[model samples]
Target chain A: MIGIDLVQSTAETLMRKAAIEIPDDYLAGLKTAAAAEDGDLSSFVLEAMLENYAAAKEDSRAMCGDTGCPRWYVKMGNEARIDGGPIALEAALRRATASATSSVPLRPNRVHPLWRTDHDNNVGIGAPEIEYGFEPGGDWIDLVTVHKGGLFGTDYRMLFPSDGIQGIKRFFLDSLVAFGKRGLACQPAIIGIGLGGSKDACMVLGKRAACLRVVGDRNPDAKIAELEDELKDLGNNIGMGAMGFVGKSMVIDCNIEVGYCHTGGMQMSVHAFCLSSRRAVARIYGDGRVAYRTDPQWFTDYQRRETVEWPQAQTKSG
Target chain B: MATGPNKIRLSTNPTDDAIAALQIGDIVYLDGTIYTAREGVYMRVIEDRVDLPLDLPAVSAANFHCSPAATQHDDGSFVLGAVTATASFRFSKWIGRWLAASGAKLIIGKGGMSPEDYRDHFVPNGAIYLTTVGYGTGALLGRGVKQVRELHWKKELGLAQAMWVIEVENFGPFIVESDVAGNSLFERENAKIAANLEAAYEGTKPAVLKRFGETDDRKDEMI
Candidate 1:
């Protein structure tokens, strides 16, 4: 019964906290890229691309205006009960979307799929996807808020490992290379690697990997931590930059989700979420408890802050 | 760097006169007015409004709309996040004509238009178009805005789908798509695509892909 307000407030607070603000580092990087003549600012065809970002920032709104499918991920204690009324969650989510729209002024993104009509807020089937995890003995609830901007269309691509020298990792990387070479038009992509699973599961896992939290700092397992580091270095070396222009940062981050495969195929899928990287998370409690507070200072100036927890770097042997 | 405004007029309709004025780096703050019409509203506007809506103000710097949310500026006077989500190719008929007649001068969005939408409608006209980064919304909105006006589109279509009109203010640092000055970044990007394809076929490829430990030959030991 406790933490009920915390849960709703947490979601509300997180949404408020989730104001789609850009970090200083990103601004600096973009300014640097735009300064380069080779950056294509002079190109006649690329003018729309330039205006899109410029207007988006000048307006202080959702970057892409897509306000993509909203998805919520929650981890909480098993015994705790939500103190609020039964429909509080629905209310909370609605509030979250409203707050996001006003604060970030998200582009009223959600629409009617078949009718092709726009929903007042970006809320629709499978949208603002909510995932839940309940712990056995905890009293508090943790809520994660995610708002993926832009389309979830064909950007997700996959490849099969070619064997011999090529393994699962190679297969994943090759797909990225092919995508880039084909001019798939991706920006601020988070390369998601789905290691092993059935065809359906493998593909889904790969797509979900893009949603994983910041890598290296905190992973459920030691193996995943190691993989995160390797992938980060590998991705950056390719020089994909923020907008896929030539630069040092190809990927904002790389995430991997290893799902046990009951079958034998080494299936790998890669889903890329474009730069308007609009996603936020806040863990909610059954007792209506909430934790992660949005750092008010986060949006305007994103100076890197130290991790709140240090689990002592996992040894190679675990 | 700050730039001064060089005022030019345009219609929502893709007219030869409108497309002629926009240029790269030209600071444009559109005035007068245009109707807000996107995919849903575009179809509805054509079906319902035999003439431009009577209540809406006349749009001079009109930009064709795809979605209300995607409309670059809600109204000429307010500041809204102005953006063109997609191009005009997929839209129903009269999109170009709507722009031409509407007296709007600029079209903002991605991708280059065909000769029909470009040369026949945009280039000969004084209008311009601008494209924006498909990503980079965060960076875009960070700059700030002054006002927002909701355009009057057929709301019955759907709230999100309905194309309403409003105004935008303090719109700055935005790129020009097809400007009145005969500049089109859309064409430039397409040219790069063509070059990338030709180079790719010529056996010339970016060396960066090779630098990564992603090749088949190096997969085993690397992983």
Candidate 2:
């Protein structure tokens, strides 16, 4: 069984890593953006961000003062068993979040929506939301922590089948231009677009596409992947770069994720993962072995399967 | 280490001439003292009429719209890790009075206020806005902070809203978003970008269903 102590310790470490380190994929993407950036002010902003990442690592401090809202995505295999059950695992994660809030010296950004009560620990009603997923096999649990900036760069719209791809592009540009001004969205960012899902699910999918996936990874569907590339180019060519200056480096990458939705509606959401796209992941095996990596590897073939039943024939052949 | 032709380092309590000499897009690094004060502090001092905690513009004329990533030990010592600014446009209502009341000469934050604000309030008060670089250069800014002098109203305003008095040297790499004459760097950039928006947005159509209070003007800024 996976030990609770191990879980908490690993979680604490993940929190620190997420706060301080810019993941390799994102760092590489930003470097490319910086190289191509020409706007005088925008270029300076990109260069400063590059240095800030290095400083964060060397000093072991958070890359951003507003460390963003901490949240979790826990995936368990069918046969996985914890030292305690899911409840115990949750307690461990919460404890780790609180401990790391103080130890990492993260700003207490979470508060009651209305009352504005500060736990100062980043824990409260629905704070540090814990989401769950299940895989088909293996006796292991994967823990993913994402610290995404809570404000700006996200929008939802209810589009119809009649609205089509043109509508999608229109709204996409609208969101980018709206938040890209003065760099509120922190552009040269990973722009994630969600199409086809319920209103709430669309938001969730777009957020996951931004935070859970790494740069340079493409959607499995060829048509959707083409759209992603098109959007990326379109965003960059908007004549806006870092801090909304005149340049060609607005989008570092574009990620699109889709889910089956209502026949008449095409719900869409756009989410921008800022320059400091903080995320870290780890997998704990039944043997108490833990492996850590940046990519969440969230969208497996099985996870995206459209068939109602698991296709054992195709799986075994593969 | 980052060098530019427009770079200028000034004291937190800069002279009026020093403020006037700055131009839009000039880079600035501050030395001496600065304090964090945003909506929470503004509301207290402006609306609630709370007595000022420390001498303003005397101890420091720079007002930072920030909340550092920090933790206080039981022994009262503090560990401040990263420092970055929040958006400043939201504080436009209370800013004019805050500047007048506190005699603040430097208003530092992210995504500066509208040019109208600069012309109306900041110009009259002899203040300018300096926008933090990258909007997340927290660690770099943290390195500039030499010490945390004091934290005020922690119990009343909580950690994020409390006033933090900090001393620093070479404390910023902020860009002059607004000038003493009220010219705005952001507005200049926005206007330039707006010239190209029609072409970039070509071939796209607005949504079939429009939301209430939605404006279709491409030039209109959300700030």
Candidate 3:
């Protein structure tokens, strides 16, 4: 069984990693954006961000003062068993979050929505939200931690089938221009677009598309992947770059994720994973072996499967 | 760093001539003392009429709209990590009065106040806005802090809202968002970008169902 102590320790490490380190994929993407950036102000902003990442690592401090809202995506294999059950696993995660909040010296950004009460530990009623996904096999649990900036760069809209791709593009530009002004959304960012699904699900999907996936990864569907490319080019061509300056580096990458929805409606949501784009992941096996990596590897073929039954044989063959 | 953007170093309690000479888009690094004060501190001083904790513009003329990633230990010593600014537009209502009351000359934060705000409040008060680079550079800023002099109202306002008095040297890399004459860098950039926005949205169409009170004007800013 996977030990609870191991789970807690690993979680603490993930939190620290998420706060201080810019993942390799995102760092590379930002470097590419920086190289292509021409606007004086925009280029300066990108260069400063590059230096900030290095400083964060060398000093072992958070890359951004507003460390963002820390959240978890726990993926478990069917046969996985913990030292305790799911409840114990959750307690371990919570403990890790609180401990790391103080030890990492992260700003206590979480508070009561109305009362504005601060726990100073980043743990309050429903704070540090824990979400889960289950895979088809293996006796292992994957822990993914994402520290995403909570405000701005996210929007939702309800549209009809008649609205089509044009409507999608319109809203996409609208969201980017609206938040990208004065560097509010912190572009050149990873822009995630969610099409289809219910309003809430659309938001969730878009957020996941932005936070969970690494740069340059595309949707499995060819048409959707093509749309992603088109959107990326369109965003960069808006003549806006870092801090909403005149330039061509607004979007480092564009990601689109879709789900089935009501026949008559096409719900859409847009999310931006900022320059920091902080995330880290680890997998704990039944034998107490743990492996850590940056990519969450969240969108497995199984996770996106449309068939009602697990097409085990076909998936294996493929 | 070498090719573009003229850079300057100024004191937190800068002279009027120093402020006047600055131009929008110039890079800046600050020296001397600064303090963190946001909505909570603003509301207390402006609305609640709370007495000033320390001498303002005397101890520091720089008002930073920030909450550092920090914590206090059992022995009362503090550990401050990253330091970055929050959006400053939200405090527009209290800004004029805060500037007047505190004699603040440097308002530092993220995503500067509106052009109107710069003209109406900042210029008249002999103040300017310095926007943090990267809307951050938190760790770099943290490195600039020589000392955390004091933290005020932690029990009353909590860590995020409490006033943090800090002393620094070479504490920046901020962009001059607004100058003494009230010209805003962001607005200038926005106007230039707006000239090309129509072409970018050429093939796109607005949503079939529009929300009430939504403006289709592409130039309109949400801030």
Candidate 4:
């Protein structure tokens, strides 16, 4: 069993690390794009961005000024038990968020929607947004902390079942062009497209896909992989190089995550993150052992990293 | 400021000739002091018809469109943590006009102003919109920020969004987006993009026609 203390502590560690470092894979993507970028000026911009990330890591400050809003993706193990219930776990996560904000020096970015409002601690209603999924039978809890910066904007669109793939293409092409123009998105933008789901499911998938790694990961489904390839090819047409300047390299990569939907309708959402798409994943095993990963492994079915004995604490905690 | 990579230096005070000397697609490094402003405070300045919070002549008369993330100190001072530029195209209405009339030489931010705005307001006033890299906020802030001289409307607008007057030297390495030459990078590229996007959409037609169009017979009509 993962103790409540261990869970909170692990979450805190992951959030702090995410706030400071541009995850290894995202930084690698930037370096690759910089080398391949043809536009002289656009390449200069990419090189400078890479330099800036180096400075950020050296200085122990966040890579981008906008440290972004915080959220969580929790894969709950059916066989695992925590010391406390759901509410307590959430409360523990919130406490970790506050600690990470100050100790990690994450820029206090949360502001109230209304007048004279101040959420000084970066946590309020629905903040540190927690998204969850249940594993049928697992012994470890995985919490993926996503520190989303609002560099590029987020968008969602619902189409009639009639509006299928054409609708997806229209939404995607429009977003890439619009986001590509005017430096709205800091290109080599990673595009995340969600198709064939209800409104919430599509939005979540799109957001996840946008920040998910494109270097090592592969879309197992041939159809989805082809769609991803098509997205990358289509992005080149934008011609808004590096920072929307004239360049050959505009988009870094594109990932599409699909969910099953009824014949009723299709909902699609597009989420864009800057070069520094920030995220970190942490897993806690039954023996109070924990490990952190840069990749969240959201949908991938894989063997566990470390095998640990099932603790007697599970029965007592449950 | 670091040089040798690419730095086109511009002074705080420049004649019309100096401004016009720059062409489209030039990346410039600024060696001047600048005043910072956000939308809320600038809107107030426009509405109230007040002079800038900071004296322009005393401080290079340059404007940087940024909302620095700052924390207050015990003695009412601030240590700036993050100073990223906001998108300048949406900064305000009559921004180019206001900057030109006020004798502001350059505006630094992300996303260039429209060519129309530059031609009408900036060209006549001899102003240029300089654009900086979006994700390089840390590097920009790391270089040449000397002091947080003063702030305006902290109570009304809050610290992060409030207007701040800062002092710096060799403060930039920004691309010339809206230049005195009456050129906008986005506008030029937008034209090229329209051409490419049309071809791209057409290119996807064959691959997606079956799944999307529901049938080959309806494909032609679907597009």
Candidate 5:
């Protein structure tokens, strides 16, 4: 049996590291926002992102309570074997989930939709979610865990089949509009677009795309990255200024994830992350050893970046 | 005495009392106040037709609700900033009239002020709009809350209906949005965007032709 304590300790440490790294990306992204003329990434947006960060920090809780369906993607190697066989993965994951919940103080956001009750532990049927894959001839298991805070206000998107290839553009633009209508304006956020998958897979990948983004990073796909850059610039130019306050900086980065579709349908889903941009990508080996491949400080810093301040409570019209 | 407005600056940490005492015009130096609040509260005030408990007789000045933090002060007081809630657009729908009727002088929030309805209703009724720094909740809260007041929502409404009135101090060097004359920055920006887009469209030309021909003409190709 894998030592539950070991699994829990490792998961806790990874989450802590990821939390600390959120703010670094935030500051770097902010500079990008300031540089653009009409960028969607605005100071107002940054401020909002920072606000979420501060709340998460001060409260020391999940950055956003929406903490949607928890999901983890794990790649196991052939040599990997737990003392207890198949149940070992489940046990280790459960321990990891427990550690993350208490250590990160994650909001007890998971629940049974029909029952309308809080799981209180952020776990439910197939929750504290994890997906595992095994390699044929490797000695290490690679674990990538993501706890997405789905802001329905920002994450939900739909693309029509008839709109054709242009539908993709329309879907994105419409998502932006919907997000704005939801009052996500002036929120310096990251956009994640998931393409080609079963309906559920598309949604999952879209959110996962956001999780994969580096605080100061760009998408690897040059074309998609360029589009993200353009969108960021255009969004800031929307004049929704910080917190929609009217200074540049709206969205800092946009991430795109492409998934193979089982069916021949053009489907896209998008998710946005506020400045906190909290996500952890860790490699847990077959030995249950974990290492943060990306400097976790980025997530921490993104959470701590600054926002505009008010000088006083009262004011006179000029 | 310190120069300028009696500014109370909080770092990223602040005490509650400091946050509670916040009044319009007092420069609040804040260090904390994590931003929170979904659309629920604003909508409750806007579309639900429920009388807001947090609604005051008149707000000569007010700022809060972008972020809320629980913080401590050097002097051992608990303060919070960014905890105050105010959404200009949603509130302006109905409370704008209430503000005018109540002789409220200023409304401070993230987005700029609104339409003739607000201007005609409030300006004539004695109100102005101010824009506060959006992300500075932590900095403001660090200064300490000057006061915290809990308002009772109409009893007929559910528990979710209640509003909390938290007064903060030294919260801004905020900008003016709508004045007695009814000017608005949001409107100005939106209009400018239209003009700029129109001009850009008019100036647009075939990029390939412009780039190739502008370059030393390809003599061989032309021949």
Candidate 6:
């Protein structure tokens, strides 16, 4: 059985890591983007950002102030069982979040909507939103906790059947244009676009895509992958630059996740993550071996390997 | 409009002439004090107009729009983590008159503030909106602020949301985009930059043509 004590300790450790440390891959992506940034002013800004990221890790404080709302994605093994039930699991998670607030010392992000005071010690009504999945055979409980920030791109859109790819593109470009250069959300942003399925599915998938997918990774589907790359290029060409100071490297990556829908409308959710996207994952096995993960591999097995075939070219007469 | 190491220092609150003399695009290194403000603090200063928990003269001279990452102690003490700069667009509501009246001759921030009332609020009052550039939060925090002074609403508003008053010397090498003459670099330069971007994206339009129109069949919508 997976003990609640181990789960609690591991969760707190993971939360601390997510709060202070950035994953290696994400750092590499920022460095790469900064190195490739053109224009004198933009280059200067990118250098500062790199220096800041380096120092934030070394400093006794967090990298950015927004610490944001807490969220978790839980992938549990069918064979493994929690010592207690969901209540116990939630209690452990709550205790872990409180520890982060005081020890890892995350900024208190939770405030009551009406009273606006520390409630449940940063563990309020349904705080630290958790998404769950079940795997067939492992005896470990897998948890990925994200310390996410930014007020933009929280509530997304539902597209009609007529909206099509054009609608999705418009939604993206407009959102970028409206929100870019504001700096409330960091620049060289990584945007995740989710299509199809229910609203919740799209939002969750989009958020997972933003938090889990590394900056340079691409969807296996050729067309969607092409869209991803195209958006990146288009974003760079927009001239918002770093900190919107007239440069070329505004957005580093654009990720897309898709799901099937009932013969109905398409729900598109767009999640834009600032450069400081902080998240950490941990896998605790029933055998008592705990594996901590910095990289979030959200869509590990869902990659599409099937190639697309084109029909015969139309004749001149046609 | 030239770039140079224009190292200059002025009083916390400068005369209208001094403010107007500072041109746009001049890289400035501040050698004085600046306070912090955002949604919470702005409301206190602009709306509530509370008897600012600070020395009026020093605060009026300059301020930063940052909700710094700070940790509060039990006795209402705190230490700054990072002075992460936020965009000034959100502060547009009180960018004019109030800041001018408060004796703020300079405002430092990222992104930028609106330019609608620049002439009315900034020009006659002698103020400028400075943009922090090239430095990340750590660079700004390490080199800029020397001491974290008083924090208002520490126990009340939580850590990051409270009003932070900090001391600094040669705190920044910020760019002056808004001058006392009411000229805004962002307002002036945006059109030119947008034109250049438009030309570039127009060339790449054909590659992702499906994004604009229904070139492909509906059956292949998912594709």
Candidate 2, residues B113-192, lDDT tens digits: the string is 98789998999999999999987999999999999999999988888999999999998789999999999999999999
**Candidate 3 lDDT, A261-316, residue by residue in tens:** 99999999999998878899999999999999999999888878888998777534
- Model 3 chain A TM-score equals 0.98
lDDT of 2 by residue, A1-318 (tens): 889999999999999999999999999999998988878888888999999999999999999999999999999987889988999999999999999999998999999999889989899998789999888777889999999984889999999999998999999999999999888998889999989889999999999899888899999999999999999999999999988878888788999999999999999999999988999999999999999999999988877788889887654442
What TM-score, over all chains together, does every model reach? 0.67, 0.98, 0.98, 0.84, 0.58, 0.83
Q: Model 2 Cα displacement at A175 (Å)? A: 0.4
Chain A vs native chain A, TM-score per candidate:
0.67, 0.98, 0.98, 0.88, 0.71, 0.88
Off by over 4 Å in 4: A1-9, A99-104, A114-116, A137-139, A151-153, A160-167, A212-214, A286-288, A301-318, B1-6, B12-18, B48-52, B75-77, B94-103, B204-223
Q: In model 5, which runs have C-alpha deviations exceeding 4 angstroms? A: A13-20, A23-26, A36-167, A177-186, A215-241, A244-251, A261-264, A286-288, A293-318, B1-184, B196-223
Candidate 2's TM-score reads 0.98
Put down candidate 5 lDDT per residue, B110-220, tens digits, no spaces: 554456655567546555555544333333333334564443331332222223345545444444456555666545544444343332222222222122233221111
Q: State the displacement of the C-alpha of residue A98, model 3, in Å, after optimal TM-score superposition.
A: 0.8
Residue B219 C-alpha lDDT in model 4: 13
> Which rank order by lDDT, best down to worst?
2, 3, 4, 6, 5, 1
Candidate 1 chain B worst ten-residue window by lDDT: B200-209
Q: Per candidate, chain B TM-score?
A: 0.59, 0.97, 0.98, 0.79, 0.51, 0.79
In angstroms, how far off is A42's CA in candidate 5? 4.9
Real contacts recovered, all predictions: 0.21, 0.84, 0.81, 0.29, 0.04, 0.26
Judge candidate 6 against the unseen true structure and give its global Cα lDDT, from 0 to 1: 0.68
lDDT tens per residue, model 3, B133-203:
88659999999999899999999999999999999999989999999999999999999999999999999
Candidate 2's docking class is medium
Docking class of 6: incorrect
* Model 3 chain B: worst 10 consecutive residues (lDDT sum): B214-223
TM-score for predicted model 4 compared with the true structure:
0.84
How well is each residue in B115-162 modelled by candidate 6, as lDDT tens digits? Answer: 665666666667788877632353345546677777777665666567
* Model 4 C-alpha lDDT per residue in residues B1-223, reported as the tens digit of each score: 1233434677766666778878667767666567677566666677676666666655666778776645555588766654667777776485854675457878888777766677777777777888777544554564556777787777666665676777766665677777776787667766654555555565333322234323323111010
